[model samples]
Target: MTKPRPPLSKELQLRVFRRDKWVCRWCNRPVIFAPVMRLIESKVRNAGRVEPLSYYHTHWTRDGAPLLDELGAVIDHIEAHSTGGSSEEPNLATACCRCNVRKSAASMHEWAKRPQRKPIKGKYGEPQHWDGLSALFVVLAKRDRSGLTASEKDWLRVLAGATADAR
Candidate 1:
């Protein structure tokens, strides 16, 4: 029997997201840090003055969330873990929810058989500035640090260093 895999550490997941610039490996789409979306939802819902619409839940609904339904960030194994791939950073990739769900456990060759995401044929092509709204997440996280989970706190530190290096 295949043993159930343990949850990937938030630290490792963040590292992969950073490495991939939060773009989905399969679709080349910018992915959102879902937890940040949840925070935004809570803040918006609590503002009593702003209630005409609702932010969709991260893992639910066809209606797009604040960033879009397909944009939730996830870590994918480059080689299938079930097929004996290691869980190391090099073997992991950042993917959006839509592509990850579609690629579920398929071998690369099999996944290649799936319809490919079309490239932007525009003169400019894909925009290069996407950081998956990670900057926004960092800002909001600092504003609401009282509720941060240990993992989130670690993210703040990592991101702080990143932010520092960028300047």
Candidate 2:
């Protein structure tokens, strides 16, 4: 059997997201950090309780949080990982949940089979500042400190530093 794949460090994932400006490389759509969507959905003003689509990777067609399921950000392999691509930053790209699942480990040949994605034309042009809703995530995460996982605490420290640098 092939050796089990090691997880990519969260820091590396963030780097790709940053480099791509929180836009999906494939479709040029703005992407939101998935966990941030979850937090928003859990609020009383939204769904009052975490909906199944919010956390269970059930983002296909839930009505309550439309974008939550479809535009959630994820790191994707630019080169098909199933075909020997390494998880190095150079081989990674930021993709939305829709594109990520659709592009799953597709080789260049399979990719060619899919329709080419043209950059979307919007009246406002490309977004000037998009952090994948990461700043909002930090704010919510700060308010829910006790709920943070170990890695989230690490992210808080890292992103908190980035946020301070921006001001």
Best candidate according to lDDT: 2
Candidates in order: C-alpha RMSD to true structure: 3.7, 4.1
User: Candidate 2 — which residues are off by over 4 angstroms?
Assistant: 1-4, 45-65, 116-119, 162-167
TM-score result, candidate 2: 0.78
The number of clashing residue pairs in model 1 is 0
lDDT score for residue 46 of model 1: 68
Candidate 2 residue-wise lDDT, 14-75, digit = tens: 88999999999888999987766656655543435442543423444546456755787888
| Model 1 segments more than 4 A misplaced | 1-3, 49-53, 56-58, 63-68, 119-122, 149-151, 161-167
**TM-score of each prediction:** 0.78, 0.78
On residues 1-167, what C-alpha lDDT tens digit does candidate 1 reach at each position? 44577888877887888888777887788787776776677667767746444455635455646455567888998777887878999999998877777887877878888896653343676656777777887888888787776766776777666565322
| Inter-residue clash pairs, candidate 1 | none
For all candidates, what are the clash counts? 0, 0
